[model samples]
Target chain A: MNNIALGRYLPLNTIINKMDPRSKILILLVMMITVFLPAGFIGYVPILIFIATALYFSKLKLTYALRALKPMIWMFIFLLVINVLVMRTGTLLISWGWFKVYSDAFSQTAYIIIRLTLMIILCTVLTATTKPLDLTLGIEKLLKPFEKIGLPAHVIAMMISIALRFIPTLIDETNRIMNAQASRGVDLENGTMTEKIRAVLSLIVPLFVSAFDRADQLADAMEARGYDPSATRTRYKVLKMTNVDYFAMAFALVVFATDLVLCWI
Target chain B: MEAIELEHLSFSYDGQTDVLKDISLTIPKGSYTAIVGHNGSGKSTLAKLIIGLLEPKSGTIKVLGQTLTDHNLKAVRDHVGIVFQNPDNQFIGSTVADDIAFGLENHCVPTKDMQRIIEESAAKVSMSDYLNAEPTNLSGGQKQRVAIAGILAMSPEIIIFDESTSMLDPQGKASVNEQIRKLNEAKNITILSITHDMEEAAQASNVVVLDQGTIAAIGTPADVFQNDALMSRLRLDLPFGLKAAKAFQAHGIEIDAVMNNAQLVEALCQLK
Candidate 1:
């Protein structure tokens, strides 16, 4: 119960929570572009500021954003070291028989790591601020225009939304089935590679069978309601572009433009 | 005037012998009908046939004046909803809200209206608070509520309960039965229940006993349960009270009893 309570959507009642998901996604896209735009410290400082500001406005904790970046910390450090020490473009600080470090290496490493950290945190902020269902709806609305290009945007978004909803459910089911199998003497989390594989296969069979049975019942329910997949559908909450949305987009665009100017200068 | 009419229905799966053989039955409109039989009595098969989930080899089903056929199966299906036996089998959505919305979404209900309907349906089954709660997290009783919510969302004219309450504990079964009874009164949805519980069968307005896919007995539950010889051959557990009363009668004790334990006590006390 506590595990469910923790993972369940907070349903935060705030301005950020109410904003159109499409707008949030568009803002996230702009932030992704910002990461690639910064050329030096001048351009980078503003982006770091922008990320902080966005995080604040979204009412998401900075620590939660930072926590999400922990797993990738190792990769970030690896890339920083590789990019700074191996690329010989500036004056050398030290030269050994096989390895050399440039004078600008420290600053370059710092900048790269910061950018990588900011990118991960920024992305996490967007997701944590928005519900998966809302984000899916937002994506659908944003991609509505792309239907002209032969993209089944609605279908894709529905798939994504439903997929997200199923993730926790699947996890819960896998856990339940694991418990049932464990009671029957299946050791899933330990053993040799082959033994583990066998355990997992045994677990998967019952899960799939249950899933199939659910599908058939769902299909029955669908047919019983005159459900037609290839039909026009309406949304539950109408997504509208608001003033906050424009403000968000503008903030992202300004960072991108500043980054471009710094690169040129 | 029958609400559901089945004629000479026969069924077999994968070149096997007939699971249901030459079955004919009629369920009157607004009637609470129970189909009872022991395991392998083919009662569940009839439940599937009525909803058009399985096609018959040689038979026809008429639901609400519309013939159950491939061409109109969609419309027929829309008017007839079914709650299956296994609570787990009927749940397709991760959450109760999502599950209820699954049916409405399929029918292309506007999202705003769909949400309201989903909420109302969940409330009808006393699952409104757990609307966004995951189905896997629910108890057996709670999952059944979600399943009922899904059926309610469809607003079908007829609802078939295919041994839905068998998996529940007694308390859970009683609660679900209460809800079903209330819904039949408030919504007027025709209910065709397939059950082996003698108590449940006793409560229904009509009872059908299936033996080898044929209609062995069909009447008010009280009307059909009086025959013990047939129930024995079908492998059904005899209703305890009825058997007790019969036992007393065999011992030369004249006793009158109804379905209640209290009534049985009074009748037994009157025994000299």
Candidate 2:
């Protein structure tokens, strides 16, 4: 559980890591749209090359991207099976009296898997290169414009940052509760369905109680520190877009445009 | 001017039963005062009231000579900071640097000066090296230190510790206590520590014992600790030094009532 690396930052001094998180998040968004542009297998050559170049420059291995995909492997397989069975369009590849396989099904599923794999890898790259706090700042900056539409951007950003801050603490609390329950003659593993549910409820009840208690204390602490949501607060760590950030954003936009043009062709 | 003054302050979660009733106290500026009490004795409630986290049911609370009102609540909070008992909950930042930055950001400190202020504050708490470290990776002591650094960044004149060291280990408690002492003596910042540990309270310039939400006794540690009946009735133990002195007196050795271990040690050494 501790080794979950989906959004873990890799502390390195590479250029990709130095790029502004705003630019990286924007690039990820552009790439996500580009991946689904119906830009056939031939068009994916440049996209894959771009990703490989990114991974190389970011000082990250292909395994990091593959690791992000590992948890979703079963879901991908399930999707492939469902698509293969449901879609009845293209050239027939195999038939067994109502059981049939078609070329289009394989091709479509391959495109979907490729698209999903690229999206996941792109997301992984963004997270791996950017610190979580910086990512939150970038998000807050992006959401600032939406605040004009009555959106509580600062509050949302604070919530995200606080939630990120407490993730490890809550994880530890969960483990502690589990251990406490285990010691009290509660069999969490090999119990009957009802017993297992009861065991989980015991863990959840204490966790929820503690979480509420933590929230209450946190509110007091924030208040004591002079936090007023409506007041104007300055940024301590301001995000500045540098030359590298601009170049990266341009490169991602060009790649996406090229992919769209390829689809039209 | 006093750092904090409470007059006729009373509070209750439900209006029927009072948690704190007609409590009045004054904490002089630059003084270290410890509010000690058993569970549900309203020590924490008093701290919260002084910091304006909770409004008293009826009474006036003044901080830095200014009465606490809804209009000036933010201003009052700016001059007063709190380090809560649960280090994990009070830590509002992903990293030590960011945590210190939280209070400064709220105060609208200029970006140009934030880095310098944060570094100075972290240095004060001896957490300069761990600025980039995540709170999760830190021990309870380190987290409390970072929390102190957070309050220090704002340069609050008075800091209220709502049992901040209660959840820490003995070493952690000692380090935090040492920091609190330094802040009071060196920086001349007023300190109000609400603690269950009598030994910690003994080190304060003054100790206020609360029993059932009323002030049972208030004086210097030595003066208060001398009243054995009051200490027992309040379910408060004597400081380690005082307790040890009493035991020595029982065995035909006479020693004056000492407030802390160092005083007791010195007295024992001088007896020869």
Candidate 3:
């Protein structure tokens, strides 16, 4: 199912892949903030173009890149429909009783869709460009100073990387288990939602049992190999932001600032 | 100098009744030794103690003459690498190449040397072609090889395998065994494997049988497997080839020399 692609999707040798993931994340934040600038085509067009270009540079194909839009399709439609019919402002293209579709509503709908699309594409760029481990490392680096106040930034970020690392493994295991059970008369996909839920119970029990078994074995293996989460270990793969990363981030920042100024003007 | 030496070592997780008691053994430099024992028989605990993964409740464990201690734990790890029973657990990286590089990275080998070390280690295990394959994409045999490559890249003086091949099928196990034997023979790296398979132990230069956390027997594979009561107690089932050889010996068939399957086969062929 190419579900393994859900794990770290970075191309191994790209220059962008080498950028400190923390820097990529900062650019994502800036772009996300710009998405909410006052509703106008003038504000959104730039963010969308910028996000598209960022993703393109990250080596992700635009077709697969746009699937990020699938999850938001219903929300976008709902927002556009609601804004056009319920807002009732400016020139009316159509009016039905108290409801009206205005020219302003059309502009607002375009603004919301563009903003959502841009923000989604920006996040996809971050994920597509950065290795999960590097992203976790970047997060740890960004949050390191707050450690003095009792936060476990490295541990938390490492947890995210571990979570990301295991997702594909778990999905594969789940599929294998499900297929095995299906062969044994477990009607997981053939029943009502409630029945399917019950059918999954058979699958979950063994999965939980195996998962715990695997975890304990892993704990023993890790402990045997000198894996101490609390111990400060040396990094083998260090992340350093290059001049290009800085420029890319700076470019994102400038675009955000320009969007804000236009919104105000 | 001994690669690993243990004297009267005993351990219990709760610090009460000993799990491994009065266990004394020494592994010579570059010896390929196999430890066979049933569940709860302390074979793995001994391996853990040798590497300082677990502290002994009593007695001494020495690796290359330095005594095992909490302070030198990292130092011990630097000199030793362990592959666990479950290949799923030991993996620290997403891709095959990345996993192989993990230990080398931990030792902080420079980046330029890392790629080559990874390639060589993978090649040693016949995994060079799949360097970029995700760990999740590999089979059990391949995963164990990746685990071996991880440890091999560390260039350890001693490598321990704790039933690492148990989950693998016959072909997978044989491929892994062939690789390990080559490493032990070629690199002079000491190997201490804790396995349930007597056939694998038969291939080793020596076998250590553990029962109830004690060293029940220590000798060549023939010397150890001939003790039926001791073998049964330790769950050290003899490999079929060896069993057949033993049966031929009981049939009043006399041979000047006998060893593994091929040797026994040759002994039978002499009858013509």
Candidate 4:
């Protein structure tokens, strides 16, 4: 269950962790665009190096970062296999009846796997170091300019962060409710497919009720504290860019620029 | 100065039986008032009404001298904060610092001073070290403290505890009580604690007992506790000392006006 590692922040003293969340978000965006733009493998060398260095500096264990990719490992493998079987070009490596594997296919598959893995790892690195609320504030700061166009940047950022925060909480709650139901002699496992589905269906109503109840109380609490969604509220944890942020942003820009040049070549 | 005043306040959920019927109450500034009642006695509804979460059908609520209306409710809310029941549910922010900064942000506190106020409020609850800690990761009492920190950071002149400690263990409740005592004493913040806990009611400067959506009794705890018939009618237990004195009285021994166990014990010793 912890393998998702979605909202879990690994507490470690590292330079990457010390960088401002806005800088990290910017770095993440640039890295994502750069890694995803190029079709060739040569461009990903910098991203791989960057991710490896970031993982080392983050003080987070390699296994934990890998765990964040666990849920998508199957998807990555499936896509890699599909690409290998579907694309046939360059030199033929193997042929059996209707199935044929090619050198070009292998390389393309490898490139995609590396790109996907790198993207997931980069995201893991971001979430693992920065707290969820900081990410929200960072996103809100980044989205502040859109407020002129009738966008509720603060509200949108808050919604995203709240969803992120509640993922683990709601998972724990689901487990609790399942355990409670199980204690009452409800067979959740070792049943027919329909029975299992029914058991799972039983969970949705309670979970919905609890979620709505929480939402209602939260609204009341927010209102009691004078929250006005349309008001122009000052941010308490404002995202400030300092020297380290500048250095990180510059480093990211260089990586992105290099990736662009490599793609042109 | 009146911290809060409710005049002729009546409310109902289904527009049927009035949950709160013509309730008139006044809490002076810097006073600790406890509203106690059994479950579904409308004490919580009254807390909601006072906080402007629920509007009464036929009366007015005033906080810090401003009457609460649809237009001015937000302004009044700035001066009054509420820590609700269900510690997990009331937390709107993910972390301790973020939650405290929430109200501050609403009040448009400058970013430069937000950290100081957040830290100061956390320190009031002795939770300064857990600024980055998630609300879910905290204990029930710690979460409640963080919620209180969120409210206190706004410097609300009046803070309402809507059965905030009902879900806490005895130790947690005691810690929250200690923090509340400090707030009332040091900051001169008015407290309106809605609870059914007899021990908490006994400790407050004034107690208002609600029964079936009406004020059954309102006075100093000593004065209110003296009305055993009303207390019994509301299905509220007397504090241990008072219960013991009553038991002794049933056995032909008289221990009158004993507010606590120590007093009852001394009176028994003197009689012997």
Candidate 5:
């Protein structure tokens, strides 16, 4: 259940959550680009404000979003420290033996850290509020223009959606297979590296066999129901561009414009 | 009209020994027929052959009056649908609605008509409430029901349950069987159930016992069950109710060949 809550939908009926998935996707894409714009305070302030407002209306817990960023905090710090240590253009603030810390490096590292943290938070908010199916539909809708260029947009979207749907099921299967192996005296823990690798090998083979079997059955089932990849298909839910979606897209554009202007001035 | 006709069909996975050999059978329209056998008894191989998933090594298969061939395979598929054994693997859509709509999409069903068909099929399987629910969260039986609904939405003339209930618990199996029965009765759809469960086979209108790539017996359930030696030689276990009835008869008590536990219980209650 906890595993499901990681990136699962919360069903909150807020405006941000109710916005069209395509708009939310477009907003996220533009917001990502805005985060990389060069600015000291102006660029980040607007982004921070936008994200905060979206999160507030999205009704997603701040802590849950933060938890998604927890694993990357160490990497962020490592990059910050590396940037400070490697740059030699700015004035040296401190020297310890051969290592030096520069004034500009401190500001640069701070910028890197804040940009990354905000980017993660914003992306997390997009995923937390939108249903996985809606996300797939949104992505397919975005890819529609490329379909004329032989993109196979629907196939790609279906693959992604099916992969996302099976993740939890695969996790459970892995656990079940691990327990079955454990009962058969395959020690998973308290082992040498080679032994651990061997244990993983044992688990992998059965998991792969089951996955392949599933794929075979899925193919047969799809074929029996008249599924053909090359055939043009009708979609059940046609995405409508609502007023709320228009508003959200406009807001994203305004923020993007401001970020670009901030970088220029 | 014959819903399905297999004439002297032979199939071999490899070029060597046959998985199914010289099989001939005819299923009447609107009939519930069960093919019972042990694992590797070529029951599933027979089903795959009928569905045009596998070509016979020799002979011909006619489904719904159309002769199945590589050239006309797609046309044959439009009239027949199958729900395979593994419920988890067979669900192609992310959600219940999407899964059932998958078939409709393939058929190029108009958007408005698709919704009504989806709703009707879901209602048939009692899965109307779970339209938006993810397939991963569903139980084995519920997933199978969703799979059935997917088939039902296509409105195929014949629906094949290829050991679809073998993976579920007793309750799950019971509910799935009940839904299948309802589909056959309410819609007059022909059903071909491939299973090893004798109890399920006993309830069917006809039972085809397959052994060593050939039909050992094909008749009404009572007529087929009367051939005790052949069934025993095929290593097929009799249904529990029939076994209990036989056991009572051996002790100088008269009990007919009841098909289920409830019938057996009621017969025992009637004793003076």
Candidate 6:
């Protein structure tokens, strides 16, 4: 369970890691949109290069980036199989009784796979380079404009950051609960579906009880520290966009513009 | 000026029986006071009431010479900070630096001054190195130190520790106790520690013993620990030093009353 590295930050002194989280998030948004611009396979070359450059500057290993894709391999295979069976537009490649394969099937599957891979890689790079707190702050600053429409941006950001902070603690609690239940002869593994669900309930009930208790204590602690949801509060870690952040943002925008122009042409 | 004053304070959760009854206590400025009691003795409730976390049914609370009211509650909270029993629950920040910045941010301290204040507070608790570390990466003691640094950054006049060290190991407890004492002595911050450890209470300048939701005894640690009848009734044990001293006296050794192990050791070493 600890091996899950989807959104874990790597503490390294690098240009990508030093960029402002807001700019990083914006760049990520631009990259995600660019990947789905209806541009042909040839149009993805620039995006792939941009991602490679980002990965290089982040100082993160290729294995870590690929690890984010490990959990989605099964889903990718499922999508490929579905596309192969459904799409029959292009010239026929092979046919075996009821099974059929076509050129467009492979091309369409490739397009989707490329888009998903690019999106996932971009997200992983953002999370790996930026601390979770900074990500939350970036999201909060981005959402501030919506506050005029009655959206509680600060509260939402607080909830997100708190949830992220408690993930490890809750994971530890889940393991402890699982162990305690296992000691009591609860077989969570190698059980029927219904029996497994019942066993999971035992673990879940205790986890929920502890989580709610922690939340209560946390609320009191926040109150004691003078946290008023309605009150105006200052920020400590201000997000300043350095020249490099601007450069990163401009680079992402240019790539997106290039992809849009390719699709129009 | 008194750091905290409670007059005829009474509180009840379900409105039937009171958790704390007519609890009137005054903690003077710059004093290290310990509130010790059994699990249900309402000592924790008293701490909460003083910090304005819980509203009293019938009483008045004053912090730093200002009466606690709805309008002035924020002001009161600004002067008082609390570190609760569970280190995991009270840590609101993802990292140590962010946690220390939490209270300062709440009070609207400018971002420019916040960095310096956070560094200084982290230095006080010897956690400057771990400022960027996550809470999960910290031990129970380090988390408490970070929590203390969070409060210290706010520069509160009085800090309440509600069984803060009860969840820590012996070493963690000792280190937190040392930090609390230093904050009181060196920084002149008043400390009101709610603890289950008599040894911890022995180090305080004054001790308040709560029994059945009332102040059973309030005096210096020496004066309060000397009441054997009351201690027995409250089911509280003596500090390690006094316990050992009594055991030594039982075996034909004359030892003077000592509040802690250091004094007991000194007395034993000076014996002819």
Q: How displaced is residue A8 in candidate 1, in Å?
A: 7.5
Question: Model 2 Cα displacement at A178 (Å)?
Answer: 0.5
Docking class of 3: acceptable
Local accuracy of candidate 1 as per-residue lDDT tens digits, B1-272: 56799888789876579999988888888788888877887888787788777888887888888888888877777778888777765665556787787777766678768888988898899998998787557887888878888888878878888888999988878888877788778888888888867777666788888877678888865566666676667666656677787787788878764554556787777767
Q: How far does residue B174 in candidate 5 sit from its true spot (Å)?
A: 1.5
Error of 3 at B238 (Å): 2.0
lDDT of 2 by residue, B1-272 (tens): 89999999999988888999999999899999999989999888898888877889998999999999889999888888889899899999898998999999999999999999999999999999999999888999999999999999999999999998999999999999999999999999999999988889999999999988899999999889989899778768888999999999999897888889999999999895
The local lDDT score (0 to 100) that residue A17 gets in candidate 2 is 86
Residue lDDT tens for model 6, B1-272: 78988899999999999999998999999999999988889988888888787889998998888988888888889888999999999999989999999999999999899999999999999999999899999999999999999999988889999999999999999999999988988989899999998998999999999988999999999999989899888889999999898888889999898889999999999988
RMSD, every candidate, angstroms: 3.5, 1.5, 3.6, 2.5, 2.0, 1.9
TM-score winner: 2
> How do the residues A224-249 of candidate 4 rate in per-residue lDDT, one tens digit apiece?
88888888788866566788789878
TM-score for candidate 3, residues paired by index? 0.85
- Candidate 3 C-alpha lDDT tens digits along A20-136: 787888888888888887736677777767766775666677777678687788988888888876776778788778766788787778767776767666777778877777778
TM-score of chain B of each: 0.90, 0.99, 0.94, 0.92, 0.97, 0.98
Lowest-sum lDDT 10-residue window in model 6 chain A: A1-10
TM-score of chain A of each: 0.87, 0.96, 0.88, 0.91, 0.94, 0.95
What is the descending lDDT order?
6, 2, 5, 4, 3, 1
Model 3 residue runs over 4 Å out of place are A1-23, A55-62, A80-109, A137-153, A183-185, A190-195, A230-232, A240-247, B13-18, B57-59, B108-113, B228-235, B250-253, B265-272
Q: In candidate 4, how many Å is residue B210 off?
A: 1.8
CA deviation > 4 Å runs, candidate 1: A1-9, A80-86, A102-112, A189-191, B88-101, B108-123, B128-138, B240-254, B260-272
The two-chain DockQ for each candidate, comma-separated, is 0.39, 0.90, 0.42, 0.76, 0.76, 0.89
Model 2 C-alpha lDDT per residue in residues A74-164, reported as the tens digit of each score: 9878988998898899999999999998888888888888988888889888888898888989998999999999998899889988988
Stretches off by above 4 angstroms in model 4 are A60-64, A70-73, A93-101, B262-272
User: Which of 3 and 4 is ahead in TM-score?
Assistant: 4
Candidate 1: C-alpha lDDT: 0.76
lDDT of 6: 0.91
After the best TM-score superposition of candidate 1, give how far the Cα of residue A172 lies from its true spot, in angstroms: 3.4
